[model samples]
Target chain A: MKRTPLYEEHIRNNGRMIEFFGWELPVYYSSIKEEAMAIRQKVGLFDVSHMGEIFVTGEDAEEFINYIITNSTFQKEDHSIVYSLMCDKKGFAVDDLLVYKFNKKHFLLVVNASNADKDHKWLLENRKDFNIDIQNRSKEYALIAVQGPRSIELINGFFPIDVAALKYYWFAESTFNDNDCLISRTGYTGEQGFELLIHRDHAVRAWNALLDKGKNHGILPCGLGARDLLRIEVGFPLYGHELNEKINPIEANLGWVIKLDKECDFIGKENLKEFKEKLSRKRIGFIMDRSKIAREDSVIMDQEEHRIGSVTSGTFSFCLKRSIGMGIIEKKYIDIGKLKINIGEKIFTAEITHLPFVKIKN
Target chain B: MVEVQDSLLYAPSHEWIRIEGDIGIIGITDFAQSQLGDIVYIELPETDENIFMNSAFGSIESVKTVSELIAPVNGNIIETNEELAASPELINKDPYNNGWLIKIKIEDKKQIEGLLSPGDYEDMISGGNE
Candidate 1:
């Protein structure tokens, strides 16, 4: 299994290490509830170095990026990021990613760890007639996310820039303890948060420094488990769980990221437009009774025991203190009736709720 | 580190039973509680329900995963822990005492003999030299 640079640091902090997508990462430093609660109530740090980063440069960088991702990028100013996805010609998601426009000539794509190689190869294959240089620089950088309502204040205290005022989805190149770093005001948690991207060698130092500096504010080192729970509470779509090659953005409730009227025709524009017209299944949220904890791949059913769809992700919610899940179900039943989830041989009753299961502090 | 009570008998799946005359007070072991993390909710069988040895009578739900509660001895449930419905975190805070789940009327005391001793349960938890 691959180990991030902060592997030993996580171990030292009593993180329960687990294999996540072939990377030896922590599931939780303490318990999932305490760590997750810390993120919601105070602040928490996460080792996100396992994510993949790729750089696109040269003269035609803007056009190359515009041709692939679903979101519009040509009008984006420098030092801004767009949450977007790359889709196949069939309108299925290749991967969801954050496209960072560094300047007019350079762009950075932060992608899912599992889809790194596939995304790189896909970009290379589609580089025909475009003067762009694509390089997979995933190994050259490490990422750390400081999230929660207090995250901005804590980060702004130590960093040179006034990051608390940084607009959402904007980033700036700065230094921490003399090491050059890039900090972005973006996160999966439904709080004012930031993800600090730095050189691989500086990961451990930066992690410890943040923890030490923010200790008084009750900053704890959280792990993937809390991250998953936090994201699910806010209705964020995780790639393998809530998205995949067969699930398009429209079905995933991510159509807001797709720009159909942009000047440049993206890879899946026409196909996605057609899929939107014939939409059958829609991603929706469900809140289960306290007795059952729905999980991934659990079959979804109506109250009458007829199968409707399958759960993409589910958990015993730490925020709400109940069982909550997200599933892609038939659009017809999303409004009409109650839903149930089949886990093992047991069936659990649930109700359809709106997008986010928990209200954001913001 | 997991705490184990030497006087109590342990099931391989981490439930513990303390024999008290003809009664067996049952709860999840400390190792079990730590593994399950914070207990958010619990589903348990009703009082007077007969549960066979090594069979699931209920289930425990934590923030991360869920585990079935297996009966350690053949018995009829005398009383279920009703406090857990309102304060599930008691299982994590004190798995042995305040977090005790049920008191059962033991059908046959010999059923306790098949359960693991504290030392054997420790070996199982410590990975049994494998």
Candidate 2:
């Protein structure tokens, strides 16, 4: 299994280690509920170094990126980030990623760790006649996320520039202790947070320094287990669970990112447009009446036992103290009737609610 | 270090049984609760249900995953934990006392002898050579 640069730090902190996507990472240091609550209530630090980073540079970098992703990058300013999805010809997602634009000739793509190689291969296969260089820099970078209500105050003075001035989905190039770094106001926790992208060599020092500075702010080192619960509570889509090669962005409720009428046509524009016209399934969030969690692959049925869809992601939300889940069901049955989730031999009563089980000011 | 009661009998599956006359009070051990982290929900068997030895009588759901609560011996369920319905974290806080799962009428007294002693259970969890 691959270990991150902060593996030793995790061990010293007594983080309960687990295997995640072939990476030896921490599931939690104390407990999942404590870490998750810390992130929601106070502040928490996460070593998300397992995330994949790729650099795209060349004269046609903007054109190539615009050609590949569903979101348009034509009018996007430099140093801004665009959350987009790359799709195949059949409108299925290649991967959902954050595109950081440096200029018309340079861009950075932060992708899922498990799909890093596959995304690199897909990009290479579709380069065709575009003049661009795609470099998979997954191994050279370490990503740290500091999130919560107190995250801004914790990270404001740590950087050379003012991180509080950075708007959402925007990044600023700065130096961390004289080392090059990129501070982006982006995170998956649905809180006011920042993702600091630095080299792997400086990851250990950076993590330790943050913990030292965050000592008074009640900062705790969280793990992937809390991260998963946080994202699910906010209705975010995980790569393998909420999305896959066969699931398109439209079906995943990411239609806002699909710019069908952009100046330059993307890879799956035609197919995606047809899919939008003939939409069949839609993603929705549900909360169980009981405390029982409805996990992935659990079948969703109507009160009469007619199968409608399957759960994509589910967990016990510490914020709400209830079991919440997201699923894709037939569009016609969305608000028509009640839904039940089948777990093993038991059927749980679930009520369809709006996306994002938890609401945050940010 | 996990705490184990010397007066109780343990199953290899990490459940403990306190035998009193013909009744057995069953609950998961400290080691099992620690391994499970914070339990959110526990599926308890209904009263009057017959659970066979070495079979799953119920299940426990923690934040991470679900684990079956295997029966230590054949028994008939007489009562279930009522407090766990509102608060499952009790299992993690006190696995042996207030976190007890079920009370059963023991079917066979010989099965208690087949269970592990406190020393053997501790050794099994501590990675000691049996």
Candidate 3:
């Protein structure tokens, strides 16, 4: 298994190691629920260096990205990140990525760890017509996510830039510990945080520095287990569970990012438009009656014992003190009504609630 | 680790039963609680429900997974620790005392002879084979 630069750091923090997306990473330190609650209430640091970072540069980089991604790339200024998805000819999602438009001739795509190899190969094969040079720089840089309500206060102590000036989904290049880094105001958790991209050799120094500086601010080292719960609480879609090769962006409730009216003929544009006209299934959130946890792949059934859909992600939320789940059901069953989910051998009664089970106070 | 009193009887599944007269107090062992991280919820059998020996009586939900608690002797549940329903983390804090699950009226006292000693139970768990 591949190990990131923070593997030793995680071990030192008494992290329970597990294999995820071909990387040996920490699952939890003390408790998943406790760490998750800490991130929502205080501050938490995560070693997210396993995610892929692919750089696209050349004169036609802007036009090249607009042809492949679903979002309108021409409107974004330098050092701005836009969440978009790349789909196939049939409009099936291949991968969901965060595109950082560093300059007019350069862009950086941060993708899921498991889909890195496949996405890199696909981009290489599709670059024959465009005047762009693609390079996968995933191994050269380490990514750290400092998330929570106090993340801004904790990170501001190390950087010299004015963090308040950096808006959401924006990035800026700055020097940290005498090394060039990109600080982005983006994170999977529903909080005000920054994702720092530093060189691989400087990963340990940077991680330790953050822990020492943010110690009094209640910053703890978080793991994948907490990350999963935080993302689920915000109703964010994970690639393997929510978006896959068989699901389209329109059906996945990501239609806001697809700009069909723009004057550009992007890949899968025609199919996505047709799918939007006849959308069949949609992702919805629900709350269980009690603390009985519903996990992924649990079958969703109606009151009459008829199967309707399946759960994509479910957890006993610490913030809400209840169980919540996200599921994709047929359009016919999208009513704000009652549903049943089969967890293990027992069926649980659930009520359809809106997305984002946990609301963040601004 | 909480010391297992010599008067208490133990089950292979890590449950402890302390008998006084015809009534028995039952709870999981400290080893079991430590193995199952943080407890979030506990599903206990209702009062007056008959429980069979060596059978699945109830289940405990932890942060990572769920574990089934087995009955040590045949009996009828007389009472359950209701406080655990709200704050199940008590199992982690004091599994032997405050985390006791239920009180039962024993139907068979002969089953107590089959229970392992505290040393034997420790040997079984520390063997690292489970």
> Top lDDT: which candidate number?
2
Off by over 4 Å in 1: none
Top candidate on DockQ is 2
Candidate 2: segments with Cα more than 4 A from true spot? none
Root-mean-square deviation (CA) per prediction:
1.5, 1.3, 2.2
lDDT (Cα, tens digit) per residue for candidate 1, span B1-92: 98999889999989999999999999999999988887887888999999989899999988678889999999999999999997888999
Clashing pairs in 2: none
> TM-scores for all candidates?
0.97, 0.98, 0.93
Candidate 3 collision pairs: none
lDDT per residue as tens, model 3, A59-116: 9999888888889878888989999998777887779999999997999999999998
Task: Give the true-contact fraction for every prediction, in order.
Answer: 0.68, 0.68, 0.21
Of the two candidates 1 and 3, the one with more favorable lDDT, higher being better, is 1
DockQ of 3: 0.47
Of the two candidates 2 and 3, the one with more favorable DockQ, higher being better, is 2
List, in order, the clash count of every candidate structure: 0, 0, 0
Q: Sorted by lDDT, highest first, which candidate order results?
A: 2, 1, 3
At residue A345, what lDDT does model 3 achieve? 82
User: What is the C-alpha lDDT profile of model 2 across A1-362, one tens digit per residue?
Assistant: 99999999999999999998899999999899999999898899999899899899999999999999999889999999999999999898989999999998999999998888989999999898899999999899999999998999998888889999999999999988789999999999998899999999999999998899988889999999999999999999998878876566788898999999899989989999998998899999999998898989999999899999999999999879999999999898999546988998799999999988999997
Of the pair 1 and 2, which is ahead by lDDT?
Answer: 2
Residue-by-residue lDDT tens digits, candidate 2, B6-33: 9999999999999999999999999999
